[model samples]
Target: MSDLTFVLAGPVRHGVRLHAQALGRRTRGAPLVNIEDGALPPGPVHLHFTDRIFGRDALDAAERLAALVGTRPLSVTLHDLPQPSDGASFERRRQGYARVVAGARGVQVSSEHERGLLEQVWGACGDGAMPPVAVVPLPVDRPTRWGPPAGAQGSTDGAVVVLGFVYPGKGHAETLAAMASLSTGVPLVAVGAPSDGHEDLLTELEDEAAAQGRSFVCTGYVTDEDLERWTARAAIPVSAHTHISASGSINRWISAARRPIVTPGAYVGELHRRAPWAVTVAADLPAAIGAALHDPTSTWIREAEWDGAALPDTGTAAAMQLAAIEAIGLA
Candidate 1:
């Protein structure tokens, strides 16, 4: 049996799978094992990925997971919690997360903003005692060697680029709208596949692009290699999220591409504190892209900072997880 087990109660998707793979590589000789919907191997500590509880029965599912992992030294991490559309929904989600907190030895959050939000919800739910909490930023792997993807390189030709999975708040429509009004007639390419049940949105966006006379292309989905190549081709990249809590996509873009990004005011504020090269824009998206194009120096500075700095190591991340788990009174 391993000393630690990573429990993936749900499907191993992007962030969850990436973190697990990194941990496996780092925790050699420590006997780290990963399992899904099966008995957890005997271990000193177990960490569960609880970032995908957005269903209608989210609270019930959490309770069931807690019961199944009974009496084990378990910790939980939320990649991104569902944004509550109203007060009632907020309360519902809070109660669900509270149940998870009550069961786990501790909880790990990615950012200070996320920690604050968790605390606020814990307070509102009147959960007796908030569990031990730690702020551990997601591990960013080192940049790989850059190579232009076949045919993808120079395919976009100075067009605006938006990368990552297509979801509701990703601001795809908003980006097309902004493109429609640009005087310079810049092309736009939105790369990546839509989430389940969101395929229609892509069709709508295509029709809207035609109606508005904006040159738009949807690459559906591309490999990581292609993503990097496409990103390098972008004249200016846009993060245009309507509401962003924690974005792995943004982190990868900034760290790898080292290019200037045009994002909303909130990201601009957040990144400026850490990465000053990020530019913020108002409601007018075209103007912001134009501004970013004019100041490529800022992007260069941002990129230079990343090139000089090293990303957090997986071994360090494993050490931090172990410390947090042990702090909760687990052996």
Candidate 2:
């Protein structure tokens, strides 16, 4: 049995909380504790850290985490880590995340790309020895039902689906522009709601889609079943994020057996390297989408690969986390 306690903080639907729940299920004997609830069990605690989940801003989140952990040994899996792409808030977030990393007994990240981002922002530890950092690639869930719906083969009648919360730089505007450029006429669908403070962006998107004589729909906050259906029906699934350390959306598409057209980036390249069959990387997203629309089957993962041994799941992630915690002497 493990001695670690997994701390759950954030909205129920948030990615961090969802990941925590998935990890907790696979991590035997580790109690999942709600951080909102007053006391916690005795022992080292593991938190899936992200500034948005913990507080209003980066500095506030760091301070709140320090207070919550108090004297307990803390190991964190950092998410939404600071990078030069953050523009105006880069330094502030870098400062706050540095403090968080400095205080942790050990740290975990989802990908090598993210680890590089952290090292760039935080630099080497005081003595020049690198902090204990573990790289656990984010797990891809196996869908309850794999592959697209029957008769979906080579069909361009379906909408172009973009999964996850809508926000600035999340690929929505780029996707819209691409669709407009292609004049594909295929509706652009956001399979999730807008992120907080970005609701206006949806209105703008709808107006743009209308002006371009293309259809657009925001299926805000869909159920898992609905998401699967959307993926199954999508003519083209895209992950064109301009600023990403790690992308859950790409993994989510993989889980659904849909190989999305992903924009090239360090993290995307890493994922592509690991599972070349999972995504189609393209620099010109519009051309990629147009090609995908012409041959929809190009976006569907073959049955053999979906059932193959190459795919990693939450269980694999949990085992890696357990091993990492033990190596850090926290388990």
Q: In terms of TM-score, how similar is model 2 to the real structure?
A: 0.95
lDDT of 1 by residue, 81-117 (tens): 5456433556666777777777777888766667777
Candidate 2, residue 80: lDDT:
93
User: What is the lDDT of every predicted structure here?
Assistant: 0.62, 0.85
For model 1 the local lDDT of residue 35 reads 52
lDDT of 2 by residue, 19-117 (tens): 878987898888899988987777899989999888778889999999898888988999998887788988878878888887798999999999998
TM-score of each: 0.82, 0.95
- TM for candidate 1 is 0.82
Using TM-score, give the best candidate's number.
2
Off by over 4 Å in 1: 29-34, 51-56, 85-89, 142-157, 183-185, 260-262, 265-268, 278-284, 294-303, 307-315, 329-331
Q: Tell me the number of clashing residue pairs for each predicted model.
A: 0, 0
